[model samples]
Target: MESIVSELEGTLVKDSDPFSYYMLVAFEASGIIRFALLLMLWPVTRLLDACGMGDCGLKLTIFVATAGLRVSEIESVARAVLPKFYMDDIDMEAWRVFSSCDKRVVVTKTPRVMVERFVKEHLRADEVIGSELVHDRQLVRPLPVIFHDGRLVKRPTPSTAILILLWIPFGITLAIIRIAIGVMLPMWAVPKLSRLFGGKVIVKGKPPPPTSGSGVLFVCTHRTLMDPVVLSSVLQRKIPAIKSELSNGDLVVCPEGTTCREPFLLRFSALFAELTDRIVPVAMNYRVGFFHATTARGWKGLDPIFFFMNPRPVYEVTFLNQLPHEATCSSGKSPHDVANYVQRILAATLGFECTNFTRKDKYRVLAGNDGIVSYTSSVGRIKKLVTGFKKVVSTFKPFIQ
Candidate 1:
């Protein structure tokens, strides 16, 4: 067999610098606290790399990123988040040569988990020789990454890291001010007052005409937690927050169930379609200079705070035409069909692609488990600890004897 051997970092992938990659792992898998710790030690890692101890620096960086993290969490990030970034950095010429081989093997100093999935699945390599064991982008993933977790939407290079650290104080203050303005002022005055505080809400396409009887479901693209609030301000009326009791008055809902930063829309829940025939598809998008308001692994409560921390946070609300009576579930259409139709309409208006991916897919990829959190009993935990201890003691019996 004609076998091709290649290095992953610089041969197939153009940029060998792993700082940004490690930063991504640290932030996504662990949290901002871990990311901050890694950043604080970055200078030392860089110095080691510059002084002929590049491998040592790489080890140090990996240690910081993966230390104390569960294997599953790190693997989840490796499988989901890193591939997107890695594929973007692939060298076209190198890939051409690599793909032409009958038998392909790739080598990388990076941990096997990080590249294995990308290499074997995306690159179709026969074997991967890394520090541990196995391999693995395309803009189109071998596996789609519908869900990912992290607040830093932008890649964190050294400069970006420094800027984020510096901006935290100002960001916190600005977040508080933005929150205060929204809470204290009337909906009609929010857009006006927000401008003075560096907040921008651009409204396009007037709201759909009101309908009589039963509440109208405002189906919106999930951009951030602030979607309903922004829409409410634009409509100059209170739009009830999500996951609330449905009332006779109109309501807002993001069928996606999670915030998606990309221009693609996740599958809408059919439950919204069954809720009412009066549906107004809203295309919502946002722009932030420094931070994103969405996260998968991090605390979601802080999303609003991070969103307001940007220098000027912008939200564009485009209200599309209301769904016709014949196009809804009331007209004998399946709930799924109506939901998909509305999804396509909103995607077209925003110039985004419609995806069948949903919230469960998002959590499963970004996090190791399904989105549900199961609490273990304290007694069950102690039993597990005792069982583990017995196994360890049994293994040491020979040595002790």
Candidate 2:
């Protein structure tokens, strides 16, 4: 496999066309990775150029005869240069005005994208000298599994897959047992599960006295979908409108009022007002991996379940002191007010930036499916109505649990 990659590398550098200047650059990939790739390609490109293989180095390969290179053009170039491996992330349409043809293409890193401006202002550089930024990022994808396996042949790859196949059954059994325990006996399971995630699930501070003489209701601030589960609470129908009622002596463990991933807390549910005077604010944060589910940026694929599947996964949970009983909607404070107070405390505890946006706003941005119309048919009208309804519902709050 190294030989294949090595040969491919040789071909890319060794066979350059004489008429067109050829040089490789990356704008996005980290410096180390792109530099390594450039080192491999650059030297070979230069050596081939030295051998009169291409009129590359003779001309300012830094400058371009053309700009606005599109994906089709990139495909053509890669085919003529390195046919075996296809690079991704190029601008798809006839877009990506990398630089004007008259300007010199400056092969530089993104962190230094302002280099030209700096030089022109500070060093009195010539205004006529133009630079085109050559942005060829690191390999778009992971090195082919074959490159690592060194078999130069194909079959199963991904070292983790083999490990998973071997221990997956045990993992499944353990997961089922753990999840069941967490559901049935929360006090016993919360700590163990918390430890598995990363931090110990220990009582961080004093908890308030039970609202009812019979028991205490814990309200934790959630950071991920698993917050309820890890805290030994149910998942389905966890939250509805704030007005929903719960049977007396029913232990309601809700965090963040709603299930969302932003770092802020939502207003407290008033339904708990009558049920419990003792409201404990639990704060926990679930970290994201390579991909993220950050609403502030954009929706990413679910990451928590896969996170648990890792061999040595880590998670953490922390508990804040119980909110003052008066602050717990006990002193004529509205549920929303109590929730805001707890959110502020939890935000301080977790060092998270609280925002005003709610989960519905997040959902609308992720998918509305109403904008692209296929002529205004009854179906289209229905879709638009549904979209409008969702937007409306997102703005209002109801009293339910």
Which candidate gets the maximum lDDT versus the true structure?
Answer: 1
lDDT of 2 at 202: 35
TM-score of each model, in listed order:
0.81, 0.41
* C-alpha lDDT values of all predictions: 0.76, 0.37
Candidate 2, 1-401: lDDT as tens digits: 11111111112123223111122222111222332333344455567667986445433332231123443333322222211111221122211221112222222211122233322222222221223523332221222110010000111122322333455466445445444444454354455564554423333555443233244455666554455444432222223322223333324456443345444554444455556666666776665322121212111122233334434433455667656766866688887777677667777887765555443333332222244342233244445554554443332212112
Error of 1 at 145 (Å): 3.5
Instruction: Kindly provide the TM-score of model 2 when superposed on the true structure, using C-alpha atoms.
Output: 0.41
Residues 173-255 of candidate 1 have per-residue lDDT tens digits of: 98888777776665667678889999998889989554444557789999986777677778776566443434546788899
Q: Which candidate is the best by TM-score?
A: 1
Question: Where does model 1 exceed 4 Å of error?
Answer: 1-3, 29-37, 96-102, 135-144, 209-215, 241-247, 369-401
lDDT value, residue 247 of candidate 1: 59
